[model samples]
Every structure is written in structure tokens, then in C-alpha cells.
Target: MSASHPDNAPAATAASAQAFQTRLADRAAAMETTLTEIFNRRSAAPPRLLAAMRHAALGGGKRLRPFLTVETAALCGAEAATALPTAAAIELLHCYSLAHDDLPAMDDDDLRRGQPTVHKAFDEATAILAGDALLTLAFEVIADAGAHPSPDVRARLTLGLARAGGMTGMVGGQMLDLAAEGRWGAARLSPDDILHLQALKTGALLAFAVEAGGLVAGADADVQARLARYGKAVGGAFQIADDILDHEADAETLGKRAGKDAEKGKGTLVTALGLSGARAICDELIDGAIAALDCFGAEADMLRHAARFVGARRS
Candidate 1:
């Protein structure tokens, strides 16, 4: 899937897509193993807390964010081993968000990944603790010398992860989402507003995933900026695709509650753009994401495939 390939070359594109999927699967399995070992090493922790953490973090979703981290590192010529801990940290933070998002006070979902959510499998308190633990542990993982040889690189990863997960990013976006649910009598937001909110909530950590790879590779500022842009674009596309899936897919397919956005009157671009229009927006973002990778040429084929997959994924 070189950038020079003709647009009409379906065979090459198909083979590239297949290769990307295989790589994604292999990376995800490796991540699963790494996470399992990390958790197992926490033997001194309370048994129930450890169980709740494992329930939330292990045997999970596509692990796309971590894949992005590892792949982006590879794109920058870093070894997979050097990126593994950082990738695991991102997944831990993501799982923490999911745990909290599924709480009774939040989305109130009973299912996740076709299994009972942590709150349902354990108690709400345990689930909350698990999320908190995961969130804190992410910092520890990033701070460890194993994540990067350079102390400066480790610091950069820590600071970046903090900003992405903190009040200005994911948490801020979550607050805005709650307000948009008519809590502040603003059930409908402008497209720009939705973009801003989603960019913060969903896009921030994803951007970090890409940028963390750059940090690990000691990439120059220009390269890091390009990868950040690519990540934000793909992240936006991912959320739009999620909105479309929520409207069209069943709970069985989603592995969680479907149509909750509409049910709760949560304002999304889908409300303003309708299904077809939302799809168009996603396509545009995907194109932008791929374009952001133009500087990397063939080295970015995996990322190009990732952007497309985010937009077109069924779940």
C-alpha cells in the first residue's frame, strides 16, 4: 500500500488491507499478554481489587489505541519492545474510562464486550476503585524506565498522558457531553461544538497515542506534529462511525447498549448531519488523516489502513 499506488488498483489495496488486519490482530494479542503479566505482577494488591481491575482491563475490545501507539512507533523506526509499556499504559487509561463510563451515574450500561460490565460483575465501589487504580497505574507504567530509555522521553510521555486524560481533555469532554444532554437546556449543539467536544473527549488520548510513539522514537517536532494531526483526524472519524453504529447496530453487535445517544437526547453531529451526512463527514476526516501521513509515504500504510478502519468499522 505505497502512496504511489494508483487509486484504481484494488488488488494491491485489498492485499494491504489484509496485511494490516493481520498485523493489528498480532499486535493486539501481544498487548493482551503484556497487560496480563503486568496485572499478575500486582500480587500484593487486595485480591478483590485486583480481580476488578483484571475484569475491566483484560480480555477486551480491539485495542486500537495501543495498536496505534505501537504502529506509530514502528513508523518512526522504534522497536516494538520499547513501545509496549507505553501502549499498555494507554490501554489501561482507556479501560479506566470505560469502567467509569459504564457506572450507574454515567451511561448506566450493563454490558461491555459481550460480558457484564465491571460494575455489574463486581460492585459499583469495586468498579470505581478499579477505574481509579487503572488510571493511577497508567502514570506509573509511563514513568518506569522500561517505557523509554531516556529520562526525558519518560517525562514527556507522563506529561502528555496526564494532559490527555485530565480535566482539559477526556474529562472535560465528558462534562460537556453531560451538559449537552439538556442538563443545561442545550440538547442540540452546533457541528463545531460537537467537533470541539468530541475532539477533547475522544481525540485527545488518541492523539497522545500517536505522539507518544513519536516521543519514544525521538522524532523531530515536525514529524510529531504530523502524527498528532493524523491521530486527531482519525479519532474524530472514529467517533462519527461510533455514532452511526449506535443508530444502526444492535446491542448484540455493539456488545453494549445501542442507540443510547438518541434515547438520552445526547447531541451529536449525527443529529445535525443525519446518517448520510455523518458518513460523509467521516469519509472526509479519513481522507485528512491519510493525507497527514503523506510525508511518511509507504511507512505510513498501516496508519492509512487504521484511519480507514476507524471510519468503516462495524463495532
Candidate 2:
């Protein structure tokens, strides 16, 4: 295996990421196609509802979560083909979160990824169903993928995704976020508290993404530990960058409505730490994430690039 982060640590410019992406760009594109097809064929689902789901999911984004799954699996010596379903399943779960998060009852955002939100594109009820369908379908995708592995391994993967996507993880984190809104005075959230919240809300699923991918690839315990640390650090960095973007990025560039965090009175790393401080924290998390890959050797360069992408992505 190659070093996950080269001592040469090439600066992660868009040009650099694009170059590294070129290495696996074809594979990633193929995975996206397969993932889209799989998502479109669920349960002979209503065409309109299915269209809504596809619309929200297929639109452009970094696809970072799925990439993490596939890339981590590859580094662990698992074929990317074998990990495709897991990657797709994680993306579905992520899409579902974004769908729900954009609802009238939630973030109430009209734009996502430079397009109307699911609820806006379709109707609220249809968007709700679309999100629910994706959430359930994610489990089904994982379960089907697990069938290819030994029964025990399959069971473990199912359990890992379920735990991470369910009440104890992503959903739970959302609940905490809802409660934390605009209560910064009495609640008086500290930076640590904010980090913990983001870790659960945004980082838990990502943590699960890396760990589950490693498990599927049959990585050793040590490798799994490294992957987990990498995921957590990268996940935190992703959210911190999100905060920075929300603060400073423009709508056209971010692909989502900017300044919603401040508009909603949401407490974030940006609000808690000032712009420069938040940016500094993002840099720190990127370094931490790269350091976590030190044991993986050269194979981890893509993962390092991924961390850079998370820290610096425009959208």
C-alpha cells in the first residue's frame, strides 16, 4: 500500500484534486451511473415520486461520502466494484438528509446545489415521501450488498449503517441541531459543544462511511482504526468548511443558498469562532485528517486529496 499522505503533501488546489480525480475519474463516473440506476428502480415506486428522488440525488455535488467509501475500500484491498453498493447506499442516506433538511419544517431552504429544493421542485408531500423512500432504500441497498459477503460480515455492515443512520447517530444529531437553534444566549454553546454537535450531526454518518467501507473491505483492526480517525477528522473538516462557505461563499459558487446559517440563527463554528478562527480550525482538521492516513502509505493519497476537497470545496 502507498502512504495515505505523501511527505510531499501537494497543495490541494482544484487543479491538483482534478488531476488526482483523473486517476479514478472513470471509475467514479461509472459508480455514479450505477448508483443512479439502482436508486431509480426502487419498488416500482411512483414515477413522480421517483423523479423527485432522482432529481434531488442526481444533481451535482462533491459525492464525497460515497467517494470515501469506495476509496477506503480500495485502500483496504477490496475491489471498488465490491464496494459500490455500500457507496451508493451511503449517498442515498446523505441525499435523504438533505431532502428532509430542506423541508418547510426544517431549514425551509428553496435552493440546494443551485436548484430548487425537493419540496420546491415537487410538492411538500412528495418531497417528504421521496426522503422517506430514500432513507428506507439505503438500508435495502446495504442489505443486498451484504448478501455478497459472508453472513456475519453482511450482518455487521447492516448493523453499522443502521446505527449510524438512525436515532443514535445522524437523526439524533439533527434533533440536537433543531433544539440548539437561536438558543445561543441561555444555552450558551461553547466551541467544544459546537464541535461535538457537528461531529454527531455531520460527522457521524461520515465516520460510519469509512468504518463500514473498511469493514466491507476486510481491513485489519489497525487499518479500521486509522480509517475511523481519518473519517472523523475529515468529517469535522467538511462541516467546518461548510460553515466557512455559509459565511463567505456566494450562492452561485456554493450551489446552495448562502448565509442561511446566520439567517436561521443557527450556532455554528463560524458563529462561535469568528471567520478567521473557523478557517484556521478547518486547516487544523485537514492536517489531522491527513495525519490519520499516515499508516496507509501511498494508497492514501486519494484519501488525502479527499480531505483537502472537504476542507476547501466551494459547494
Candidate 3:
């Protein structure tokens, strides 16, 4: 089937949706194989450390961010092969975040991807080290000539990934999240405040994922900006969906402890807006994401499906 779809058609029919799912699974498997091989080839690391790193980085999850990176690159007319390393780099960073986020000092979760979390299966210190190693490796992956033949493209990917994962982005938003728990006696965040926090903490990397493709393909400035906007909107929808699921999903379905946000007093959009209101916001963000891709015409149908999937996902 053609990747293109009419602007007014459903984002995906059952068959097309299955096709998208197949594509997502294929990319995810490829990413996992690449990650596993990278860890297996490392001879200098201690056994436990290597095992922990491999455990945290090599398996599980939807691989959505990498999918976005590859798809966006494809949409921008670049070959998927040209973008695979960068996609892998994004997944490495994402896994690093998940490992760290599940630490005792953070979300304190005991499960991830239907397995014991890094900190649970391994010692906390090892988990922390593994996360750190994965994070650092992400930069190395992006900066390597394998990610892009052009030195400038590799440099741009490195810089963009750094900014997206740095203090002013994911880390900064995490800090805000901790503070919102009244750890420092800060007031409970308003709806707007929660939105801003999620935008930075969760949205930044997603924005980078979409924009990374444009960067790799050397898309013009306007196209890049539009993709960035699309990323931001989708990111918001993703978090809201997460919040909704947290409130409603079981541990088996969610692959983590549910309702921990409220238990920990973390300020979520759901907390500030209520369930129906949060759903409304999620829908709005999905619409905005789809609109942002209007310029890409039928070439962006898969991305539009992704936006809808994020909003409607049950887990």
C-alpha cells in the first residue's frame, strides 16, 4: 500500500493500521538487535556492568521515539538506512531516562516493560551506572560517522540530542516535577504549569525525535520547524494518555505500578484538569499534531496515525 493517504480519510483503516503496526514492530526489532550487538561486542566492561547495561537497553517497549525518527526521515525523503543509527541513539537516550526515572529517588517503580526494573533486577548503583552509560553512549552513537556520512549532520544530531536531554529540557522538567510534589514547599501546579512541565520533560525528546529526521535529511528550515511543532503536540498527547492510563490501567497492562502519580503527589494534567478535561486536552493536541503535518500532504499519513495512536492507547 502507498504510504500516502487522503487528508480527510481516517488516519488508519484496520488493514493500514496493521501495516503501521508491522512497520513499528520491524523497526523495534531491528533496534533491539543493534543494541544487543553493541553491548555484546564490548570486551572492556565488567561482566555485571555490561549485563546491567544490556538488560536496561537491549529489550522491551514500543520503540516509538525511534519510529518517529525513522518515519520523519522517510517523510523528508531520506532512506531509513541513513537514519537508523540516529534512531538507535534516540532509543538509547529514552531507555536511559526510563532507567533513571524508575530509581528509588524518582518514580521508585519496581517494574518496567513487564520485567523487573533495572534497579530491581540489579543493585541500585548498577542501575544508576547502567543508565549513565546508556546516556553517554547515546551521544557517542549520534556523533559517530555511522550515524551520518556528513560530519555536520552528525554534529547537529549530537547537539540537538544534548539540548533535548539536558537540564533545560528533560532534566529541568524532572526537577520541576519533583518540586511540584511539594518537596520544597512549592504550591501545587496549575493546569498551565503542568502542561509546561510535561512539554519540557516529556515533549522535548519527542520533538527532537521528529526533528532529527528532518535534520538527517537536510530538510529546509520551514519543514523542520513544522515537524518540531508536530512533535511538541504529539508529546503533549502522549503524556496525557499516560496520565489517563496511570489512573485506570492495571500493573500487568501498564507494565508498572498504576496511580503512582497521585500516590506520590506528582502534579499531572489529570490531577489539574480531571479525567474528561484531560481527555479533551489530549484530543486537542492530537488535532494540532495532525494539522502541523498538513504541509507534508499524504506523505505524513503514518505520523497522523501515530498521533491518534498516542491519544487512544490503553497502556
lDDT of candidate model 2 versus the reference? 0.81
Best model number under lDDT: 1
Higher-TM-score candidate of 1 and 2: 1
Report the lDDT tens digits of candidate 3 across residue range 1-315.
Answer: 223223433546788778788888998898888777767667688889888888887778888998899999999999987888999898889889999999999889999988999999998999999999999988988998889999988888999999999898898999999999888896678899999999889999998999999999999999998998899999988999999999989999998899899898889988888898998888888878888887777678888888877887876
What TM-score would candidate 1 get against the native? Answer: 0.96
Q: Ten-residue segment with the worst summed lDDT in candidate 1?
A: 1-10
> Compared with the true structure, what per-residue lDDT tens digits does model 2 show for residues 1-315?
122234536454567667777855665686679667786566487899889989878857667777788888889988887888888888889999999999988888899988999999999999999999888988888888443467777788889888888777888878777777854344567899888888888998998888878988898888888888889998898888888888888998887788988887777988988998988888887788888887766678888887876765676
Look at candidate 2 and give me any clashing residue pairs: 2-297, 2-298, 2-299, 3-297, 3-298, 4-297, 4-300
Error of 3 at 207 (Å): 0.7
Pairs that collide in candidate 3 are none
For model 1, residues 1-315, the per-residue Cα lDDT tens digits are 223324512334667899989989999999999999999888999999999999999987899999999999999999877899999999999999999999989889999999999999999999999999999999999999889889988998999999999899999999898888887675668999999999888999998999998898888999998998899998898888899999999999999999999988887888888998888888888878888887876777888888878877888
Which lDDT values do the candidates have, in the order given?
Answer: 0.88, 0.81, 0.87
